[model samples]
Target: MAIASMGTTVLDCPDPRTLAAFYAAVLGWETAQDSDDDWVELEGPGGYNLAFQRSEGHRPPQWPGTEHGQQAHLDLDVPGDAREEAERQVLELGATLLQGDDGGRRSFRVYADPAGHPFCLCYPRPQDT
Candidate 1:
């Protein structure tokens, strides 16, 4: 069967430009389109495109224990040895630790972006022997 590629991943946020800027800095992406207040697009690595939509009264997702639930989240790729520094960098960039960093028991770390959208900085999973 022929396969298809996902065009773009869109997220809902209060300010499209602000959200786009945050993502651009995090992912080292460039803004492809952000000339309007209602929508903004940040060009991602490869063909992956991320668009932020202006969501009125946008309520950020709650990690479990809540009815809102996690709207969606991004799992960022980070080298195993670089996770520590990455954690520090993301925190400085306004990410709030959500989970997986309480005692470093997990392979991945969870954080919420400036707009309260959740994302992760993960060490690459090892291949099964």
Candidate 2:
């Protein structure tokens, strides 16, 4: 009795192919065969899909501010032990850190993609016993 099932999540960017490649690298996904210049799709594991579409006047959002604030963002999980390596990989893959460790207090670090969309690399919190 649901209205519809899940579909691809699309991000508007200046160049679809380039953005798609970036996400593909970050997510370890593969580009769909039907992707093209104006629109590109990535086939993620578990039937999930992510896509990028060309926008002539795309403006990346400003995080932690009201002006052009974040419309949406992805929260990717990283194991506690691999957090440093994950951060290194993302930074090498064109992600810029917006916020980082606060004396080991926070469980997540914020970052912006090459196009300035904000996303977080979240680490698992210690469970109380």
Q: Rate the local accuracy (lDDT) of all candidates.
A: 0.82, 0.90
Best by lDDT: 2
Question: What TM-score number comes out for model 2?
Answer: 0.94
Candidate 1 lDDT, 1-129, residue by residue in tens: 659966889989999998888788888998884447888888766788999999999999887546887867899988877888888888887889888755555678888888888898978544411
lDDT string, candidate 2, 1-129, tens digits:
999998989999999988888889888999999999999999988999999999999999998787999999999988888889999999999999999869568889999999889999998756511
Measured by TM-score, the strongest candidate is: 2
Model 2: per-residue Cα lDDT at residue 14: 93
lDDT of 1: 0.82
